[model samples]
Target: MTRRKLNMGKNNVYMKHWLSDKDRFADLINGSLYQGRQVFTAENMSVEDGEQGLVLRKTDGKEIAVQRYRDIMMKADDGTRIVVLACENQDEIHYAMPVREMLYDALSYVDQVNALRKNHRGKKDMKGWAEFLSGMKKMDLLSPVLNIVFYYGEDEWDGNLDLHGLLGLDRIDYRMLKKYVPNYRINLIDPKKLENLECFQTDLQIIFGMLKYRKNKEGMKNYVQNNRTFFAQVNQDTYNAVRAMLGSGQHLKTVNAKEGGTVNMCKALEDLYQDGVEEGIEKGLEKGIETGIIV
Candidate 1:
């Protein structure tokens, strides 16, 4: 696997802020995971505290904690069951993502079990020895958890996508072991690789579309110009995200956000394009003078 270290100066703050918005979060999940279906809505989903509290008790009474922090987490409860969705913003391709995600899901399940245990203890109900030790009733169920790694890096992901991908099963693993070994998969969302840009209903469409060419100044300028109707004005969050994703430039620094916290991406891109042209002309003259080619 090709692992590129994240730039020490770069961070995922902008991506976290962008994904924290419920509308954008739902759109991203639906578009990327659910075939563009409206599985989650801004109204139905409620943001939850993502601090991992699921812990294991020791014989000496000291709790062994598996603490983790998530960028954004949301929960939705229907009449039948509860569902949890967690987002982990990644600035680079995480080589051990499958195991990382597996732990998050496992901890969520353990938390659910703890909740069930507390409820049963409060009600003074325990049917058998199995329920008492397990911290859950026989019929008790756990909420399903889905963790997604939103990778917004400059390079393609070449790391393992699942637990099986990480294992060296080629030499010794037989079909018999497959039944005993449980495998886990990581849900990954790569905006640059998404083909269905229209699936997104928010500024995300513009964000994803622009991110695909973030490395190419010419392509980025063309993208903004082509989407001028929307790029002329974007909210502060989206603007900050675009600037962060594409990296800082002279023109980007010059464009002040509007009074109402909106930025003119169209104007910034145009100025940036103009800067490139002027630099090209100046550099050409410099080269010509150095070689005496223009004489």
Candidate 2:
């Protein structure tokens, strides 16, 4: 098996660190994935370091050192029930994301099964090996693992959202094969597709709301102009992330340097709008002159 290096740029690195915070991570998951379920809390969440070692050996005796790292993994308890949660953050869309996510979930299940066998009281008995190895019965129930993909790309995700979607099958064949093939659907949280801003709480409301309008400069400007109070109350880290991700970092810095207070994104948006308008007019004028000369 060939090993691939995990390459992350400055923006992705910063985002990973930012999401590493338990509170912030929980807030995002609970708000977006759970939909106000409020089942997750910072106190209950714990980060799990991913697997690292020789995952496979080829027939040619070549060993492969592979690392599978998840962005976030934790167990959340709602007083009586506990569920395992894992999240993968993607800045870009992956076409084979469903398969990748399936692998992660499968690995987690394998680990859980191994742990069960190790802790079994009857391990010393001869029947223990048969029972554990045969996968006939289990002494304990495994917690359900929920895997989610948090996609933060500016453009819409065009990749397949489920295992079935990846299979190249005709409509008739797909219906026929449905019974034999197991389907796993990816839980994708895409900010660009979100419609209800009111569904979000805390910093996420602002983050997703801005992302929903990130491509529309005029829309963003209008949003900031109307919701000055909301923009003003944005935390510093979130402010920086939004401005940087939206290509307004320089403008934000200039405004902050001049005014020397809480960064007003509304003013920055106004400047960006004005700059865009001027640039458009200049291009239009140039095009008009060229057309006239040609005529």
Candidate 3:
């Protein structure tokens, strides 16, 4: 494969090496974003006009050119292409209502190009975001479908965001686009959950092993104190496997050597001591100096 490269910045200025990784991540993200459903096709990346250039083509031969200056492209597994446009930064509006106007110009040209090609393509929508609230009011949807993807993750997401209803398909202002374009579902991938799968697997497994080991040590110590015969009844292989399963040394000297479990016991005892002190103080105070005859 001739690694086809298109510069997303002026004069073919190369981005950091991580951009290649970001591009690959973009693919997986799109896949995961759409839940493994096809939603985008990516091609013709350029940035001469200020943003990268992208061609979003659908399986039916319909295509749209999304200027990358303000938008990003996501090619789906089923050959659907989604254009993600950012109009907001740091909880502030970046673009005004001019985005709806820009859509008119961009999509008008897309329609003209499609007409000339003797091929009509897939439905296209605009993904929009802004720091200030801009709307999809002025777009000429009669010419082409108009859909907007708005960035809703503002700085203070106090579970108080209503941008969805403002931009949802049911909104009266968005009725035109809903009537024309097939509304693609938008789902947020919790950034914490979307971290690398390997990181989650390894870190979680390590923590789990540590916890299991701690539990086994506590259980073994309890058994030794109470049912002393339990250890003698077990085979050598069983004993070793139990120790290995808990990620602990089998040697008697090493078992419970660190007193890690004892820390938990100590914490509980401290809580009990504090509780007893509080009760004793309260009980004496409730008597209200009765022994002194001051009541």
Candidate 4:
């Protein structure tokens, strides 16, 4: 397992704040903009209510009470409702349930709400939702076409389990989030990210500002110049993109992310080279001493 060295720099500290605010960060990292209102509920409801009467069978006597429930709804800014259901802290029994069964549980919630609000409340048989539900039910069950997210902590999950691998939504799930919940649409928000002191320092605002500035062609060019160092650390493809932007020769107003400064990619590369050389020398000296038998 390759361990990542996390820098406790000002920017990383700020990342913690966004990480800590699970609801808030969930909106941001979800690749979905934070336009919808986030709603949490502990109350449960179903499509049909159960009666007080219970029936017993003669052959193999048994009694059961049937219940119904609906999925949680997140109302979006455009007045569209998203049906979201979360199943967490599931134990052995819940885990033993087939994926389809779990999905059915989520679907039942949507069904109950759809049936109850068909006319008097909300949009009656919202066309989009109806089609969406149908697709969920009729689609190939074994292929894993679900968007269930799982939230877990660091110690709880092994790195081998890729969250996107579990959900089969690689395009939707980003590289960072794949670290947790290796199969679900859910992201593991480190509680420590919330406690970071730098959150109050307006790191999110800075990131948001950069995102906003990168909207237009000229702005994007300037953003590349400002973030040359960061791009260099990423991949060659990313570096080439930045280089293209810089070479585009489009004049844009300088963003105040910091100030206009040379990235010195060669310097960063040199530092890495020097560190490797030092490590190699140290190892060689240790090995030589061990073999000399001068003790």
Candidate 5:
């Protein structure tokens, strides 16, 4: 297999690692996706390293390598029912996210079936063999999997959220294609679209609040200033994530988070200022040369 480095920058890396934490992952799922229907603890969640190898055949019968990985997976039980929850974190919008998520769910079901077949083979009894031969009539139990995509990008997701949308069908062709293609929709969590900040219990409340008003500098500043106590209480990871999300240039210089000590927000701002100044000088020089040419 060919090894390639992922180009996800520091912000994306930070977000991925932050979401990998059990508590944060569970909180995000519960607060955002399920809407507190299923309360999941960190103990119930597990990080599924995104590394699955599969080969696909093209129309020419040439095989190509494909690997799949989910950001996090969790097994949750609400006493009567059990479920497998898979989450994918995206810093940017993927046009084929719905199909990608559907594929992931399908692969998980396939894994379950394979595991059941292996278990059936392990049974040496005549009854087990008989049941296995009968298409595993006794092993009908399978956990339902729920796939969710958490989108944290600054802009609105313009991608197709439903599989059917990618079919390139016209209005007239919709009826014809209805029976042939299945529609799979993505459960997208966009912090920017969140209307109620109270729904979130953890630091996500503050985080989402900031995201909602990210475009308005004065609004974001007011939010951070008003929630001084909350910022002071938030852990280092959350603090850092908030800083990163707000852009490296904007951060709370006064608030010293307890977990990772003091974060220097001013230094990043200074660097940004220097960059802007240099860019302005370059632009000025270019404009001067253009004027000289015109003369």
Candidate 6:
């Protein structure tokens, strides 16, 4: 593949490039959210705008507009149903991720409501006051928004995983409050915790597998050797993403180019440890720990 210098700033940008592929996007959603249930496929998915924005009227009649961008978003339609799928790439842990995701989901519903209302108003299809006031018919329902937080960090996650975890409502004193407040959970996909890497059909399988050993030089080398054929011929974006997330700069220098926009990952690994396995491993780990964004 065409070798390019790694952009150390915002590695998540590289992640978006490779995972943007329809097939790979579907594969990631299926494997991460559905546990390989095959609930989504590239054929039934269409890319959607990742921007979420809406205006809300407050009790004082003042309006506020807010906007947020998702790392990736798509529409999933399966004849009888449609759902919105969004992925948020994270290099470091956000302690308030649950609350952030909850806001994104709420705004998604608001966006849909605006669209549905616009269509109805254009067609002059309102039947009653309820439809007119709400901007949608009583029976109309919003598509469910499922957001997954894809954490590629190699370190153990010590952060809370749900809204309730952040709410501090689990104590006996707040039992009554906890019973009434529903919990919102994040669909977290951590490479270190992935046990069913085989569920992935694409290079995502091998990529995630190798990520689990990112800090372990010997272990990562072995994993690459084990999946040599596929990694040895990955697309430019794929190689860039993997190397970016894995902190390969401390060791890896050039990507050995091959035919058809592919690279030999085996040779890349060889150069990574050319100075000595332990030295390379130590440097990689030190750099990863320094950033608190290991993967």
Q: Which candidate number maximizes lDDT?
A: 6
> Considering lDDT, where higher is better, how would the candidates rank from best to worst?
6, 1, 2, 5, 4, 3
Cα deviation at 52, candidate 5, in Å, is 3.2
TM-score of 5: 0.74
Return the candidate ranking by TM-score, descending.
1, 6, 2, 5, 3, 4
lDDT of 1 by residue, 40-153 (tens): 888888888888865689999999866987888999765665789899987667898898889888878877888899999999898889999998887888878978898876
Question: Model 2: how far is 127 from its true place, Å?
Answer: 5.9
Model 1: CA > 4 A from native: 1-10, 54-63, 172-176, 247-259
What is the per-residue lDDT of model 2 for residues 206-274, given as tens digits with 9 covering 90 to 100?
A: 667777567687788777877888776554456666654564322444333234346666666777788
The residue pairs that clash in candidate 1, if any, are none
- Report the lDDT tens digits of candidate 4 across residue range 145-260: 12232221223343323334445446554655555742423333222133322332222323333333332544643554576555334333222222222221322222222233
Over the stretch 1-295, how does candidate 3's per-residue lDDT look in tens digits? 3322221121112111112223333433344354434333334222112234448899999998765333322222333332332221111222332343354336544544444333212332323453112222234222332223322122223231223333565767777776665323222322213433332221222222322224344544443434344333433332322322232222221123132222232233234445556888888877768677346
RMSD of each: 3.7, 5.3, 19.7, 17.5, 5.8, 7.2
Each prediction's TM-score against the native?
A: 0.87, 0.76, 0.26, 0.25, 0.74, 0.86
Q: Which is the better candidate, 3 or 6, if ranked by TM-score?
A: 6
lDDT of 3 at 199: 28
lDDT of each: 0.79, 0.70, 0.33, 0.34, 0.68, 0.82
TM-score of 6: 0.86
Clashing residue pairs in candidate 6, if any? 1-262, 154-294
Flag regions of model 2 displaced more than 4 Å: 1-8, 50-54, 57-66, 117-127, 131-137, 243-264, 281-295
lDDT of 6 by residue, 1-295 (tens): 2233234344788788888899998998888767788888899999999988887799999999899998899999999899998999876778999999999999899899999999999999999898999999988999999888888754667789998889988888887898789999998888767889888888888888887777777887788888888877877788778876786423455464555678777887877766676777889999999999786
Q: Model 5: residues >4 Å from true position, as ranges?
A: 1-7, 54-65, 125-138, 247-295
lDDT (Cα, 0-100) at 135 in candidate 4: 34
